[model samples]
Target chain A: MGKKIVLTSGKGGVGKTTVTANLGIALSMLSKKVALVDGDIGLNNLDVVMMVENKIVYDIGDIAEGRCRTKQALIQDDCFPSLFTLPSAKTMDNSRIPPRVFVSIVNELNQDFDYVLIDCPAGIDEGFHRAVAGADEALVVTTPHISAVRDADKVVSLLSTYCMKAVGLVVNRLKGNLVTEGATMDAPDIAKLLRVPLKGAIPEDEEINLSSQISKCKDKSSARLAYLLLASYVDGKDTKVFDCASDYRGFFKKLQRVFR
Target chain B: MLKNNTILRLKRILLSDKVNMPSGLIQLLKKDLLKLFDSYFDIKEESLKIEIDSNADGEYDVSIKGVSERIKSPRFMR
Candidate 1:
């Protein structure tokens, strides 16, 4: 069965949705069937990030309420084969899903894909619980700031109880220069501070701001490579870990090596 | 977005990668984390520019909001 993993953050606006969408697309690019679940419920935003909001016919709410079948609501990408998004309901209905329902939906998705990435909402509320209840693992996304790291630590501690398999960290918006200058926390420092395994680190990108209108990003974009590296890591690939500092240095080195 | 060789490298790793974390499983922490966030946001709502809009897609999309919009916390230093 494909892995059922939830991407969560304790605080809001930490790029959880961006990570989920890119990871799903990148995994599917490897020909692995990937399904993305918007676990935010009432405040569903994954569809917008994936650019499938208008395509959502039957949401998880409909499936939970027995109004529609599971497969009916899936929004498959025409360009990216084997990639699908199970969007959350945009309405204000009670977004609280029972644990059994959440598990059932994830289990059903797991049967058909190589990976199921759940986009968990910020905050440790009922919505967050329902999102994490059905996952085999959890990936907590955060920045290098003190508040973000503090919340991330709690997320790791919280997932220790719910995530059956393991809990990992994806340090997003890492500015290597800032860390080097002591302006922000570094990736390894955040991992050690939270006591969670470091799965991936994403460099901050301006392109991510424009991604909501268009569902895709440039292939060579820093955020794209970071997310692809993350997808590779999640797939158990031994690819070289992403080096944010090398973002500038490595580019020139590769160019020099090519000429040599 | 990975090169063909990079994808192959990933496939080889997947042959043995099982989503293992160094701190795999531990005693559950429950709402202990929630308490920490609540206290941090408790008396700082005024200085903190918190925004939670569901319709900000294609703009703030997944959330151009959260705590990243210039709300530096003072507790980390103290």
Candidate 2:
């Protein structure tokens, strides 16, 4: 069976959906058959990020409700035929969909795809519970602030109850320049604080927001490089994920490095 | 009766920490606790003052009292 990995975060607006989209694209780039499931039921946007929102007719709820077959719901990406997305129900209430239904949907996807990445809704409510229900693995995304880190820590603690086979951290919106200026915590520090292994660290990039709206990120900056490295890791290829802090070298830091 | 260990764990914990309890445990407490709490207290749009004190028997006694007066401050919720 393919690995069912849920991408989730406790805090909202931490780019959980964006990370899911980029990872889906990166994994597809490596010639892996990937399926992106939008687990955010009421506020589903993974299709929009994947640029398949226009093609969605039968949503996940329809499949679970037995109104449509899984094949009818799967929207194939034109850019990457290997990448498929199962859109979430836009009008359905999150509490209405049972965990067993979501699990069964993912199990079916696992038979065909190499990777099933579930984009979870923000906050640890019924939506969060439903998202991780079918997953053997999870990546908790968080920013490098105290509130976000605290929320991520709570998520890591809650993942124990679901009993995932593997769990890791993805620090998003990491500003290396701010870390160098002692304004924000570095990815490693945040990972250590959360007590989860760092799977990925994506830097703050306007390109990410811009590209996902237009298309998935194609530029070779810190954000894209980090995601590609993450994809390589997920592909079981031995690769080091990029450190966002390495890009920043201020005048004082340069002088300090010179002195050292 | 709530154990001392349970109270100790509850101390200084955030809402996210306490809210994610097992469904079985929540169901076990909800029905009994909700009915019991409803008899004595009603939720009002005001801050509550709670006090906990240890008696001579070394058991914690918890009390809850609603604030009668409302604050007309701009930062009432904050």
User: Cα-based RMSD of the predictions, in order?
Assistant: 16.4, 12.8
Return the DockQ of model 2.
0.02
Model 2 per-residue lDDT tens digits across residues A200-220: 888888787677621345455
Model 2 clashing residue pairs (backbone) = none
Instruction: List residue ranges in candidate 2 displaced over 4 A.
Output: A213-218, A250-260, B1-78
In model 2, the Cα lDDT at residue A136 comes to: 94
DockQ of all candidates, in order? 0.02, 0.02
Give a tens-digit lDDT track for model 2, residues B16-71. 24444343543354455544444444534233434344455746566655543333
Span of ten consecutive residues with least summed lDDT in model 1 chain A:
A211-220
lDDT of 1: 0.72
TM-score of 2: 0.73
Residue A106 alpha-carbon offset, candidate 2, angstroms: 0.4
* lDDT per residue as tens, model 1, A1-260: 98999999989988888888888887887778999999987878888888777787799988888989889989998778699999887784654467689789999999988999999988998888888997988889998765676677677767878736978889988875565445556677667656678888888777877763123667667677877787888888854456675643546755853564
